[model samples]
Target: MTIKRITFLQELLGLFGLQERVHLAWISSAEAQKFVEVVTAFTEKIKSLGPNPLPAYRDAPRAALAAAAH
Candidate 1:
């Protein structure tokens, strides 16, 4: 079930060229080391990908409106 959800989410993100940002992992609570490793790797991957553009895209319309007001 979780895999199905992740696949669907990946497809949705793919439409926006962000499918790589999605990750699925199964780690037991007892395995803290594994958890740290996975998180560290994912963080590095995100850093390598650079910043997300969604914030700028989301603010564009507001920026245009402000410019028009001026």
Candidate 2:
């Protein structure tokens, strides 16, 4: 169930050409170290991916918000 949702989001991100910006991980609450490791690895991965190509979306929060508010 969770995997389906994650895969769906991953595919959706890919459609927008922002796949690297989203990551999925299954870390148990008891595994704090694993959580840290997953986050660190994901951070490094994102760093390697460099700047996002879709900067306009990031800069135009007002537009997005206004559209959503309406």
Candidate 3:
């Protein structure tokens, strides 16, 4: 079930070129170290990718409108 959800999200994100931003991991509460490692690695990956472009892209129309109103 989790795999299915992850797969669906990956596909959906792929449509916007953000598939790499989605990660699925199974970590138990006892594995604190593993959780930290996974989070650190994912954080580094996201940093390497820089900020997400979708926000800017999504707001472009609004920005244009605001500029035009000025």
Q: Judged by TM-score, which candidate is best?
A: 3
Model 1, span 1-70: residue lDDT tens: 9999999999999988899899999999999999999999999999999988678657766764575473
Ten contiguous residues with the weakest lDDT in model 1: 61-70
TM-score of 3: 0.76
* lDDT (Cα, tens digit) per residue for candidate 3, span 1-70: 9999998999999987899999999999999999999999999999999998777757776764576473
Off by over 4 Å in 3: 61-70
Q: List the residue pairs that clash in candidate 2.
A: none
Best model per lDDT: 3
- Considering only N, C-alpha and C atoms within 3 Å, which residue pairs clash in candidate 3? none
Q: How far is candidate 3 from the true structure (C-alpha RMSD, Å)?
A: 5.7
Q: For candidate 2, lDDT tens digit of each residue in 17-58? A: 787688888899999999999999999988888877567568
Candidate 2: global Cα-lDDT?
A: 0.82
C-alpha positional error of residue 65 in candidate 2 after TM-score superposition, expressed in Å: 24
In model 1, which runs have C-alpha deviations exceeding 4 angstroms?
61-70
What's the lDDT for residue 70 in model 1? 39
